[model samples]
Target: MSAVLELTGFVLTLGGWVVIGATLKNSYWKVSTVHGSVITSSSLYENLWHSCAEDSIGISNCRAFDTLLALPAYIQACRALMITSLILGMCGTLLTLLGLKCTQLGSNSENAKSKIAMLGGMVFILAGLSSMVAISWYAERITAQFFDSFYGGTKYELGYALYLGWAGSLLSILGGIFLTCSACKEKHRDYKYAATRQGKDARIYIKQSETVTSAKDYV
Candidate 1:
């Protein structure tokens, strides 16, 4: 059961990273509003690195951001956070692979494997939080822009990429939690086994001492 849970968690964490990567690269995190009540409308879509506009005729044009320094603070921050999360997720995946019981890397002892798994879980948690922070920051900015009354209101609506980011964040968090729980259970079992062995050894030693004492008295 533990193995299943750990494996599921690892898979979910890996999938979450894939989702986040796609979200970051996608250019549809937001889409421009349609002015007409028409069923079909042309709109602009944008992501962290680029923006694309589509016309009613289905022609599309895309432009990448010219410079990182010229980007807004939120954009810069989101990019940083997302990249950091990706790096951490990669590290965590590596650690989780090593920790797997079927693998030989840290399989010398159950304790070692558990510790490695726990470390991976910690990394996953950090990665998840980073993703969540970036997404929330971007969402907050979008909300503020949308509600702005003083200036031209936000012309965009929340798009698919943002939803994907949210789903990925949730998966990472839940998977990390499962992995952490497995690690904790393994640690507890190790402690219990050690205590039982210690008790048995102590009993055997006491019996030996008593036997020697009785033999001495008889002699």
Candidate 2:
């Protein structure tokens, strides 16, 4: 049962990591709103790296951000967080693979493997949290600007990439939780087995001592 849970959790974590990568590559983190626009001939969309505009004729053009320092603080921070999440996910995945019961890369001791698995789970959770914060922060900014009555700038709406990021983050978190639980269960089972064995050993020793005492008295 624990093995099954661990495998399931690994799958979820890997899938989430892949999804996060896709989210990062996706172009539409935010799209310009058409609510108050008089001209509907063009639509603007943007991601962390670039901005794009699509015409009514379905032709689209894109331009990468020219300068990193000139970008908004939020954009820079989101980039950092997403990159960090990816790095952590990579590390977690490697550790989990090494720690899995089905694998032989790590120490033969179950205790050691369990510890490694738990550590991997923790890293996965951190990765998920980082991505979650970045996505949520960007979304919050978009919503805030959208609802501001005094703001005259072009209002934007949440894009599909944000949804993707949310989904990925959630999956990663759940996977991490499952992995952690499975490792704990295995550790507890080992502890119980050890305790039971120790108790049996004590019982056998006491019985042998009693038999020896009886024999000496009889002699």
Candidate 3:
């Protein structure tokens, strides 16, 4: 049962990471203004890496930025953070796989395996947090720019990509939490078993000592 829970968490986390990566690559973090509820040429959509425009005739075009140095500080930061999170997620997934009870990679002992699983869970949690911060930071900047009265008349609305990011972050967090719980439960069981063994050994030692004393008194 615990193994099932761990696997479920791991799969969910991986799914979340995939979604986040796809969303980041997608040029739909925000969509340009819609006119009369219809998307026109001015309906531009953008993501961390590129921007796209949709025309009234249903033509869509996209272009990646030619340069990164020219990008805004928030954009640069978002890109960096998201990339970092992806890296972390990759590493965490490997660790989780190795530590899984169903795997024998690090199964020298249940205790050691549990520790590895816990470590993987921690990495996954960090990956989730990094992605969350990046997405939230980018969203906040957008919100600020949109609501700013001094800002130009050009308007943009939150896009599907942002929603995907939110969903991905949530799933990653939940999955990591599940994995952590499983690790903790394993650790507790290990400790309990060790204690039981120690108690039994102590009882046997006492019995041996009592037998020795009786033998001496009889002699």
Candidate 4:
């Protein structure tokens, strides 16, 4: 049962990691709002790296951010966070694979494997949190600007990429929870078994001592 749970968690975490990658590559993190506009000739969309405009005829043009230093602090922060998340995810995946009971990569002891799995789960959770914060922060900024009555800038709405990021983050978090639980369960079982064996050994030693005492008395 623990093995199954571990495998399930691994799959979920891996899938979430892949989804996050897709989210990062996706271009539409935000799109220009069409609300209160009667005629829309073109649509503007942007991601962490670039902005794009699509005309009514479906022709689209894109331009990368000219300078990293000139970009908004939030954008730069988000980029860093997403990149960090990816790096952590990769490390977590490798650790998880090595720790899995079904794999032969790491130590043969279940205890060691369980510890590795737990560490991987923690890393996975951190990765998820990092991405979640980045995506939420970006969305919050967009929504704040959109609802501001005095704001003169173009209003943008949340796009598909944001949704993808949210989904991926959630999956990664859940997966991490499962992985942690499985590892804990295994560790608990091992401890229980060790305790039982120790108790049994003590009982056997007491019984042997009693027998020896009886033999000496009888002799």
Candidate 5:
């Protein structure tokens, strides 16, 4: 139950980061573009902002159309990532809860290395999730405004959007790394568990062999 809640939150977080990353990528693209640079200038922003609201905002307009096609895809990707991140987050939450709830917690052969891995993985998952939520929300708003600017007069707004997307990328990258780390933690934990179990079983077998050899000699 708690796992689901935590996971849901994590998913949103990762989703936000992914959105931020995508937005940043878009921003970088624009910055490099000939038109993007021109449109982003302060003077241009003042003249162009709110220009589209006064007209049909042209479906055929090349620049406008570019955003329409590209932004939707970006949004879609963000959504998909959001879903996946959340689900993983849920798994992490469940793992933590189960680890905590087990009666014979320490006796279950959870080795230190494995435990560390699991813990780290959970942390990363959380970080990733948080990033996703923050970035994604901003992305959605930016996309909407970009599309709504039909009057072709939104230089400042568009430029600002580009800048936000640019700045947000840092968060996106950091969050992504953290999320990935959390997964690694879980995987390492599994490896440790298996190794510990194997060691214990080996010790048992060795003792049994020794006991059998002694009995044969005594006979």
Candidate 6:
């Protein structure tokens, strides 16, 4: 690809990753903490009153307030956003790879810078995956505590989407680890097409060699 196109692809993909990561951080740490605290504090009063202990039942300000209430709304929103970001990232990665190929990027290619660009995308994917654990923990808590409370105080059952999101998050974590290693891999070899020219000592030669490139080149 031309310099202009290459630069554009890198900027878009990198920026998208940043946006997704920022969203997750804000939702999990900032929003969840403040809101979660309030919910927990309120629930203590209710728990004290509703439990088997008779003395604490009629105490003032005994209304229970479980943090799980604040937890679900935010968790659901975060899950939606995360799923969207994953799809978006996949698209951006594919486009970036195409652009790199256009610029003749590959291990043996003259324009090897494409490899680095690919590695950059892989890193972004890894980042997304790493955050999944934090998100999942929070999400599961929200669903189990808050959602289940609605149906006669039974343990809540996660819906299909919730389960899918959980599964996807786990997969993303694994994928990120895989990609991180793949991106750092240097010296990868593969078969190269070769043809022999007729001569006195003509013989077919099969070239097997590795391509070494840095992650930065893809960008």
| Worst 10 contiguous positions by lDDT, candidate 4 | 33-42
Q: Which residue segments of model 6 deviate by more than 4 Å?
A: 1-80, 95-127, 130-138, 143-155, 187-219
What lDDT tens digits, residue by residue, belong to model 6 across residues 156-175? 22323334434444444444
lDDT of 2 by residue, 1-219 (tens): 999999999999998998898999999999999898898899999999999999999999999999999999999999999999999999999999988999999798899999999999999999999999999999999999999999988899999999999999988988988899999999999999999999999999999999999999999
Our model 1 lands, by Cα RMSD against the true structure, at 2.1
Each candidate: what lDDT? Answer: 0.86, 0.94, 0.84, 0.94, 0.44, 0.42
Ranking by lDDT: 2, 4, 1, 3, 5, 6
N/CA/C clash count, model 6:
13
Off by over 4 Å in 4: none
lDDT of 1 by residue, 1-219 (tens): 778888888988988888988888888888876643254466788889898978889899999999998999999999999999999999999999888777788578888898899899889989988999998888888767766766464466788889999999888888888888888888888899999999999999999999999999999
Residue 140 miss distance in model 6 (angstroms): 2.9
By the lDDT metric, which is better: model 4 or model 6?
Answer: 4
Each model's TM-score? 0.92, 0.98, 0.91, 0.97, 0.38, 0.35
TM-score of 1: 0.92
The TM-score that candidate 6 achieves is: 0.35
Any idea how many clashes model 3 has?
Answer: 0
RMSD of 2: 0.9
Residue pairs clashing in model 4 are: none
lDDT of 2 at 132: 97
Model 6: lDDT equals: 0.42
